[model samples]
Each structure stands twice: as C-alpha cells, then as structure tokens.
Target: RFPRNVQLCVLSFLLPSDLAAFASTCKRLVSLCRRDQRLWFSMCHRRWGSQTLINKWGSGRISYRRLYRILDEYKNLIGFWRRCGDSAAPASSSPPPVFFEWGPSYIAGSRVFPSKNKGYDAMIEKPFLWMSVAWNRKAMNYLDSDGKFVLNEEDLIGESGFVENELIRVNVGKNKITYN
Candidate 1:
C-alpha cells in the first residue's frame, strides 16, 4: 500500500545505522534486512540504473558472491516479469542471454586444483562473480566455508558442487585428485 511517488532516497536498505533509518521502519520487507541497493533503486530509479545499483550493493559490506547472486537473480526476475507482462514485445528483446559460454561443455578439463599451502577454501572466498565465460587453460576450484572441496560441476556430480566462489576460507591438503 505504498504510493508509487514515494521518494527513492528515503526507501533505505534498512541499514541499522544512519544512511536511512526510515527504511528499517518498513514492517513487511524485513526479509531483506540488509541495506540492499537494488530495493532502493527499484523503488525509485529507472530500469537502466539497475546495473549501477547492483554494483554498488555488491561493493558494500556484504560478500561479493551474495551480492552478485542477488543482482543476477534480480536481473533474471526483471527480464522474466517484463516478458511475461508484455507477450507482444519484440522478438529481439526476448532472446536468451548467454551467461556462460564454455568451449563445448562444462567438462573436467576446465577445472583447477587446490594448492598444498592454500587448501581449496582459500581461493573460493575471494570475490569471484561468474560472468561472460572466459577461456583458461586452468579451470577454477571452489572451496566453501566448510572444509568440503568441490572441484567439479554439480550437474553430473550432484550436490558435490563446490562452494560458489568462497574457497579460500579453508585449509587445503596435498591430496592429488583426478578423474578420467
């Protein structure tokens, strides 16, 4: 029951501190307890500004992966809603987006291993927002906050998908692992 004209800057991310104490006052949106820039922009800014807001939201205190996931999901949702609402939209506007482009497919060869000193967790923790697939002789490894190491795609491996870009958080061991 909010007026569409509500000012954008006042719709805070509900940050506990000063930025916009008023944002925290919203009773229903308590789900997004953090100061998410996307919510703010959606309430106030135009669609084109979404990318900038997403980048800003990511660079803040939250982990890059979480922010990236939120932003990525937001983008997908926006596209979905737009298309669903306007079935007659131009075909060019409704094409599938290539989020990732692997050589032929997501194969084991495009995988990286964990170093002895720095276990798998150490690298995954780093800010690795997956986008525009790039070619690399060395594939990437993901070590989640837990000690578990996931070096392969989850599609075939199932729940074994490595922690998404948060690997450096664990201690790696010198165990050689390879699959044919």
Candidate 2:
C-alpha cells in the first residue's frame, strides 16, 4: 500500500469530480479525502498559490476544499474585459476597458487607461469592483465608488450599487460578459 503522504500526493492531482469518485471507492479513502486538511490545502495552493494567498481567501474560517470550489468557479474573471453594449452616452463618455486581477482575498476589476506619463507604454488601473467569497461561501461583489474598493459595510451605497450571489456572469469560451 502507498504511504499516506504518497496517497495524498496522488489524490491532490485529481480533479474534484475524480477525487469524489476515488473517495467513493471505499470508506477509508472517503474519510481521508474529506477530513484531511493537507490534501485540500495542497490542491488549493497548487492551483492558485501564484495568483493569490489561498489562506487569506476564507479568513481561515472555511475549509480549503470550499475555497478551492469558490476560486474555481470564479477563475474565469481574472483577465481583461471590455464593455460591449449600446450606451446612451456619447462616444467620448464610453466606459474604459476593464482589467480583472487577483487580489489577496478578492478579485478586483479595475479601469485600464493609458498612463499620464508620455512616451512610456504603461497603463494605469483604478479599482472599479471587488468580488469575494463571503463567509457562507456565497459569492459577494462590491462596486467601488470614488475609485476605491469598499472596505466597510457602510461604504456600500444601496442595492442598486452592489449585487450579491448573482452579480456577473461570464462566458469565457465566447468572451462574453453578462450582468445579472
């Protein structure tokens, strides 16, 4: 039989669905796969370690497995996106291109604009929205007003200003963005 460490290593490589199948094979593996912190932590770290601090995701209150699921669901939001729709505003008033990037505990969407410094190919980013996994494992999104991400509950304007649970839907395969 493989050592526990070796078994964990193997299990970490499997996708969540595959891991679930492996766990269903026997009771011992079910216990190991569901209860072992190391395995889930390893899976989360391996996937998103370079992008964000996996430990900071759920503030240590939730399991790494839940964190993995949350990040996996929202992984497609970590790239550049442009607004596509008819705007009543004039062409000059059109929204800027948005760049979504991973933060320590949230995915932040920023408005990308050419840098004020001339002759340099640098772009400036201003935070526009922040998305995070709430304590209940539901996705939460906060709109940034005044060019800063909301830090406190009081900073939220109203229901119309921010969305919860179903904020935005992204079709990565088709490069489409739908607001819900």
The best candidate by lDDT is: 2
Per model, state how many residue pairs clash. 17, 0
Cα lDDT of model 2 by residue, 26-71, tens digit: 9989989888999999999888999988876655567888888888
Candidate 2: Cα lDDT at 32: 91
For residue 111, model 1's alpha carbon misses the true position, in angstroms, by 30
Per-model lDDT: 0.33, 0.73
- After superposition, the stretches of candidate 1 with alpha carbons farther than 4 Å from their true spots are 1-8, 12-16, 19-26, 32-37, 40-180
TM-score of each: 0.20, 0.75
